[model samples]
Target: MTTGSTYTLQEINALSHDDFVQALSPLFEGPPWIVAETWSSRPFRSLDYLHASLCAVMYAAPLEQQVALIRSHPDLVGRAALAGTLSPSSTHEQSAAGLDRLSDEEIAAFSRYNQAYRERFGFPFVICARENKKESILAGFEQRLHNSPGQEIMLALGEVAKICLLRLRDLIRS
Candidate 1:
């Protein structure tokens, strides 16, 4: 996708499958396979349709694939964020949620929570950072850590869908 550029629905609808995948690859943290697989469902009727199609691909995948997708996400305020290795969308989302301005104690708390969550769930805690402030995110970690593995996976996947929807809105005009 072009940096700082937005696409009209008409333009998006007219793109080739390869081009569509390229445009949407950044919607998820890991592989672009979700968008790649969803490409066949286009031309989307609306922005919502496009997002639903992408989420459908994600949700319809086997449990192993779904877990892999969750594994692909980086922890909040974890090593990747501290090291400046996060993807552009991730960086922006985290920054918007005030994650970039955390105090040392706050960072350590996040690190601890992230470690605990991963130890319990075997995947990074996923949330729509663009939709939560630092406080809420920490609270989410606390509350969600108590969830059963099955519950947590579905919750994380729903968060992934929220993240993807926001990213799609940022990229495509309805």
Candidate 2:
């Protein structure tokens, strides 16, 4: 697989569909479908352009595809196995890492909220979680659970896009 930041424009352009997706695996934490759609078209002039195009594709993708992207994300409650897997350049951005510092009561409450959210939405709770704390995330979960399925799905997708954008920015900047 292509590793590090040494890809040439021609190399990127020459990648097959599967190769491209593999190279971008670090970017999409959730489902393969999301990475497939996002990386199908390559040959970006710069990272900014790439990020913009990704956002456009995400917004234009089908609902199921969007959900796949959101579902690809790692559970918010743990450290990402790979470096740079999550955005915001801090361990605190990881849901699990941040929650690890919380009291048992807080963790229990978050678990309950997560279960309730999944029961209602048919998927795990989704959040950008860059600078948010455990309390804020749980509050968000509570508030978002009240939204209709259609609305929540859209909101989840938007959060996924934001997470992708942040990660992409960091990828290019590094």
Candidate 3:
């Protein structure tokens, strides 16, 4: 087990079975099972391996599970953010992109677009918020709306992977 502001790669690679899951569970927004599943493939040689292992678990998951994972993520500037109840990571990422400072018109636009995207895809719009600005997120929502459901599913999962990688990088020491 390791506990600190950051843990070295070696330290993480050496964690006990349960400790490993506890350390990495927050990397994904959805299933807590992802980390436990990933922990079985221990001795990750690098951060990339750690990320790839997680993605593999998600990819190997059932279709319903993958969709559940997608659905697990809150909408950008959605109810959680509005109620000041977003997870710490989400709050920070969203605030960094000015999501927390939206104007009334902007909030309305986001709310409307989020609803439309959900109606079309059956899941919330997802983007790596830390890697994007407010404008790009809105633009992406519009663009992705045109994609087929299959394409959107793949893209959304890929976005989730990117989010997990960024969060994992934060958790692991450089």
Candidate 4:
């Protein structure tokens, strides 16, 4: 779909399931199944309503669904497909502060952290790339990995909300 004008509430609501899912593709780079539940409804009255409702639903989602959502986030250090679709400021933040641009020693440390995190959580480490710096992201990865499954799941959901909020704001602004 064209990424030109901001979609009206009506226009957004009228989108087909596939289109609606496509519209949200930039938010999390996971399987369409991760978003299928959200797309099951439509007719949002406004962007705020949509965002709020989505946040509620996401927070209330089952653990399996939450895991899917968390795993959907793009890798912190890689050729992320959604990188270009993110808001320019967010993209700039990632470029200026991402682990991908870290020094050799930092990259090595991140790799170890990434492996340990995945081993602990059984999923990729997640962070709200917009407001985080490399150091903070790494710290979060380390801290969150120490959480119990229940705690880590909740933390991941919160990060998902932050990510969705950023994407929703960008969608309306675009």
Candidate 5:
């Protein structure tokens, strides 16, 4: 479906499990498992319930799986972004945050932060780019660097939830 296409809650509730997974697959970065798991909670009462169910499945997953989800995301303004290899949703999200318009110095700063965050936390730093501009994003990179690994995991997942919520808001009609 087109990024601007939205599904009515009734229509979403009626989709087959496989179709449901396919429809919502882009809501998460990597895995369809989260949407797959949420299918069991179908006939959702509202968009809020659907979003909560999806996030519940993800948050309940084992730590390794959670980390793997975070790992699947590309670094902000990193190689995939520069190479024009990001998923369309990601490309739009990054571009919205002005990451696509960075200067050489800004690119270097992002590279340094991306490397440092990966080295420290074993995963790329994640944030809801739609909620930030270049300055706030850079500030976030600096501030979040001080977070402990476990804390960063929770924080990153929270950011993922925010991203998903915005995506859901864009795609779901109550």
Candidate 6:
């Protein structure tokens, strides 16, 4: 995410819709519209309320929209991670999980699972990698493979929400 000033809720509320979206869209992975929608209900009482409202918009989204939102996320140790092209937040999360230190065999395993997950689910495998280790993430990939499409979609969205919460917490603290 791009660094900028810490914003008061009032300051957030005062921005134009485009400006607000520009400021906060990094918290989510897609176009700025969702955050733009959340902007209308502004003057948030707390950071929690702001995050909740942003999620409210996501929760109300249709199934396809939700899927698109999930698809916006990068795969764990996929091309973006390998090439150092991941967003700052994503790079940090993956590094926190020690993905940046993977051995060759580990990278091979991760790539295999990533491709399989994409084949089955039509999107990257999403997880809140900030607090996870490589083993848990690999285990998650194997376990989640058996889930039905609807379940996987919800699970991915939940992971995405976790990512958003961490981002929000950081932003507010900054």
Which pairs of residues collide in model 3? none
Answer with 2 or 6, whichever has the higher TM-score: 6
Task: Give lDDT tens digits, candidate 2, residues 129-155.
Answer: 764667788889889989998898888
Worst 10 residues of 6 by lDDT: 1-10
Give me the overall lDDT of model 1.
0.91
Off by over 4 Å in 4: 1-5, 78-93
Among all windows of 10 consecutive residues in model 1, the one with the lowest summed lDDT is: 1-10
Report lDDT (CA) for all predictions.
0.91, 0.65, 0.89, 0.69, 0.91, 0.88
TM-score of each: 0.96, 0.73, 0.95, 0.78, 0.96, 0.94
Tens-place lDDT digits, model 4, residues 1-174: 124446667777888888887776555546655455577667777777787777777778787887887776655664352345544434554665664467878767777887888788888776777768888988898778779988888887777777777767767642
Residue 14, candidate 6: how far off, in angstroms?
2.4
* Per-candidate total of colliding backbone pairs: 0, 9, 0, 0, 0, 0
Report how far off residue 128 is in candidate 5 (Å). Answer: 0.2
Residue 155 C-alpha lDDT in model 5: 96
Q: Give the TM-score of candidate 5.
A: 0.96
Better of 1 and 4 by lDDT: 1
**Which scores better on lDDT, 4 or 5?**
5
Residue 149 displacement in candidate 3 (angstroms) = 1.1
Between candidates 2 and 5, which one is better according to TM-score?
Answer: 5
User: Which has the higher lDDT value, candidate number 1 or candidate number 2?
Assistant: 1
Per-residue lDDT of candidate 5, residues 58-173 (tens digit): 99999999999999888999999999999988998999899999999999999999999999999999999999998999999899999899999999999999989888887887
Alpha-carbon deviation at 129 in model 4, angstroms = 1.2
Q: Mind sharing the TM-score for model 3? A: 0.95
Candidate 1 has a TM-score of 0.96
- lDDT of candidate 1 over 1-174, digit per residue (tens): 225668998888888988888888898978888988998887888999888999999999999999999999988998999999988888889999999999999999999999999999899999999899999999999999889999999999999999998888889875
